[model samples]
Target chain A: MTIDDGPASDRVRLRRGANNGVYERQAVLDVLDAGLIAHVGVATDDGPIVIPMAYGRSDDSLYLHGSVANAALRAADGTDVCVTVTVIDGLIIGRSPFHNSMQYRSVVVRGRARRLQDDAERVDALRRVSNHVVATWDQARPPTADELRRTMVIAVPLLEMSAKVRTGGPVDEPEDLDGRHWGGSVPITSTFGDAVPSPDLRPGVGVPSSVAALDGTAVHGLTTRP
Target chain B: MTIDDGPASDRVRLRRGANNGVYERQAVLDVLDAGLIAHVGVATDDGPIVIPMAYGRSDDSLYLHGSVANAALRAADGTDVCVTVTVIDGLIIGRSPFHNSMQYRSVVVRGRARRLQDDAERVDALRRVSNHVVATWDQARPPTADELRRTMVIAVPLLEMSAKVRTGGPVDEPEDLDGRHWGGSVPITSTFGDAVPSPDLRPGVGVPSSVAALDGTAVHGLTTRP
Candidate 1:
């Protein structure tokens, strides 16, 4: 998890909190696994566009999908894309206002994302992304051939990815040591509430065991649950 | 709040949920107020770069600040920037995985952001931004002249902005009705928790009432709180 062992390129370097940062393969995978949506940044002809897209991780590869006609997805194919997933744990309110920061675990992956041309590979990627949001989604109902044809999936190998993280309290300047401002942290925790059945649900269809079994936290949080 | 009443540009038009979507002045303001970060999309020599930055709203304008020497600030001055703020409220899980979508509220403002040349305006914008994050922050410690000199603030009038929102349950296709699959939603709510006191707080200095009384939730939900 040391900074020295992070991505070799300068772009993925950790500028802040170098001491407490984690850039190891396992650490980056953990952060990605915990996140559901990824803020995807793509360089477009007009400018850089950041779109919130659902993503999935399989081994060391990251998969993303959008409509087949989506320009961002088309442009991202065979090009370098900066995919960032940020989980804000809390607001680190320091003694001094200047020291205030966010306690977040973020992974910035910079790599060339190529379109998945193989049908089997694309279907597998789509299934992985579907299960990323819901564990039982893959087994629920498979997408028809027409549906698969209309969807575009891209894969980015995580060879050059890096995870930069910051935790703990604010590091205020020496002069602000005795400041009277009340500051510490406002912790943030993301959880899933009980599934609310659709109002138009069909009769006699009981809730799936997978959906009913879900607790009030993220699906990935199940492993961490006591 | 109809699409016709919004910006004349085709890109700002609502393609989905046109009937239920909102584009009114207050709706746009509400979306801005509910968010703390904005993705500033700027054009670079190579391609477009989108960076996440803290933002503040005042009247009909949005303000963003950065170091004077930062390339983003320099490139953004007097240039058309696409400032977007999005908050995902929930995961709209549907019976068919293809219908799974995110319940989100997002506002996009497209205009040329002008740098504040006047010192007074810069200071005022800074105050507005600081107050947006923490209501009592501006009055707590006014920026010194040196601090002001080191920072650059840009203001973009919210004139040609559009608010796009998607709420309620999933809009599943009718054909998937009888499919024996679970369908519902995973709700998400963000809130401020009990403030923790700084470890180095001076004895006898209590938390200010302004900070203590703060209930950091979507302003629209203020009256809807349980």
Candidate 2:
């Protein structure tokens, strides 16, 4: 396997199955936008740790916030970190177990993380993060100044990134394509159930459009549109 | 946030919302068994990198594959690595943006990785990895000696691991629970579609049992049971 360049970037090191490398910026963005959580890798004195963190995407940045895992980000500030998000599509079952694979879309973003200290940017990023998960900014109470301080928001530019996608039927070895074994892809699907309302909801409160309009692709980013 | 002991080891570094920590070994094992892919973190000369790879869970070990991404794993051989797998349940919506989060179950296993060299173990691990994704070993053509030799497999002990879980309704601030904002959990659903037969599938080969049974929760592991 040799290194194949993607998007003329220094960070992308795709090899082996270079055909799976996706170079389109829009394609990479689509995966990032649809993904719910990103696995963040940051190095520390203890060793390298990869953490699953919920992220919000802007046009050029990814806001990662999961207050509980803030320690990893805190250490990642000004240091290179790898953020990977993947959407599994299905299982690729070939004529042989050796040829079986998975259909997935993955994006790896690498860059130095910057901690957000400014209140306005922090609030905006937080709002995007909130809406990214399930839009609740408009009706929900806004974050107080104290809450903002308590929360930690880290931003990573989406400039250095790469995308890989696997689709279609399995690629079987010539000798094994005898048609005796069953081969095809079994699609993995996620069906959203009805919303479970809070026990002490206000009398007139109804499900928000964001909660109502989850099409399984992802939560619509329109509600928080500027 | 403070460090709490989970199953007695020097690893678990959980902080902030310590109640989220689930210290039981069985709970950790359950997450590993259910997950299909894991984001593996390995420290390389380039820096810390996280690669999402398909993994199969054996009692005390995990076999990581995704042959294309084997480069990262090869560099991690005999080195400390962190493996993190996550299963997202729903979006935890609070009355305020600051309190919003996602309901998830995640396990973090940390330890050195050893590349499997023995053919017997390699074939065994590969079969487990295949079954873990979708059971297809029974009817599918078996891997040849050459194919097995061409493949790469690595194993990591399930030691120094931690599990974190977030469930239930949002933890709303007393002041903001006025029922003004609609808040609850929107479950994320995955539904598997019918098997898409390969373009050149053998006419009489019916779908395998593994392909027939996909419950969204996961592909059942009974077929691969010894």
Candidate 3:
């Protein structure tokens, strides 16, 4: 498939299924912001490593949060890294097994991740990360000074990024559509169950609004509200 | 954080959050089977790239399937690669944002992927992959010979692997527990939605038992049954 449109970077080019590739910056950012987890790829002496880590997006960069001692976090420093976030929407069951596929939206960002050395920047990054997971950042207790010192936050600029999405029902060949086989799509959604309050919570402290608002909401498509 | 009993390979060691790392083989396999998609890491000349791909597991290896033109599949051949599968179970909302975390089970496998050159092996791999996606592969139309030829399958052995998991309520400091903030865990579950029948399906062809069985089932936890 031809390079329809997107960042003209070699690293972000889609070599296969070009029709599903999305090059728009806003689209890529939307996928990044919607996802709370990213699998970060870092090259190491042993080989390449992919680790699942919590992340947040701000402006043109993605912030990855972890402990300073995390292997993947340490390996990503000064080296080119890939951060990929995927949200599976459904399973497309076609008439034939060959045509069966998944409905998903995935974003891949490649850049050098620089460690946030400034404590203020690092704390801000952590807040972003927290907000991404739970929309109630201000209501939740902020990290203490010592806690900020212990966490490692890496900022990867969204210089080269792409979003690939697959949706709708299975695309079966005309001949197979007439065959005696059923085909369809099963939607898969991420939902939150009942909130189990902490056993040691004080008697008067009730479930905060920020935490209660998460019920029945989509995990990735959390509302961007106050 | 001690290196609790697990494969002691240097590549599989947990460098951080040692308390959350699990070293058992069965535990790792459970997480692998419970995940429909994996973020695969491959080293390239430009840097490291991670891409989301569909995968199936056999006795001792993981099979990755994609079109022949997929770049990440081509790059993983004969090179060390990392495949990570993660299932988010819940959100650990701590009293402090710093302590907030996700309850997830993740498996990381590091090994060199070998391209399946043998047609028999390739077809078997494809069958396994299909079955992994839909348990009723026997009822669905099998892949034609040409279709089989156009697909690429890579086999990465389960050599150096580790599973990291976080479970239960948030662990807040004693002082924070008394603070006027609610803290707990919001369970996250991946559930399947209704199956929308294909518009072009023949009038006589109704939803098959295989397709109807998918309702209410977890996407990754589908039983390996007919």
Candidates 2 and 3: which is better by DockQ?
3
iRMSD in angstroms, per model = 2.7, 1.8, 1.4
TM-scores for every predicted model: 0.87, 0.92, 0.95
Docking class of 2: medium
Residue-level lDDT of model 1, residues A1-226, one tens digit each, is: 3564656566566554467666677777887887767767776655455666789878868999888987778988988787777676666665543455667777777778899999999888887887775665654666778878889999988877677577666766566667666566665665667778777778777776666665475433432211
Looking at model 1, residue B66 earns an lDDT score of: 78
Question: Backbone clashes in each candidate structure, one number apiece?
Answer: 1, 9, 0
Who wins the TM-score comparison? 3
Better of 1 and 2 by TM-score: 2
lDDT of 2: 0.78
Residue B206 CA displacement from its true place in model 1, Å: 1.8
lDDT of 2 by residue, B1-226 (tens): 1224555455565675668887677777777776768999999877788988888878888898656346787888899899998988778788887777788878888888999888888888888888775667777888887777778898999878878888887888887777478778878765577889988786888888867866444432222332
Candidate 1 chain B lowest-lDDT run of ten: B217-226
Worst 10 residues of 2 chain B by lDDT: B217-226
Q: Find the candidate with the highest DockQ and give its number.
A: 3
- Give the range of the ten consecutive residues with the poorest summed lDDT in model 1 chain A: A217-226
Q: What is candidate 3's lDDT per residue for B4-74, written digit by digit as tens?
A: 57664878887676688888776677778788788999999989999988888887889998888788889
Model 1, residue pairs in steric clash = A48-B48
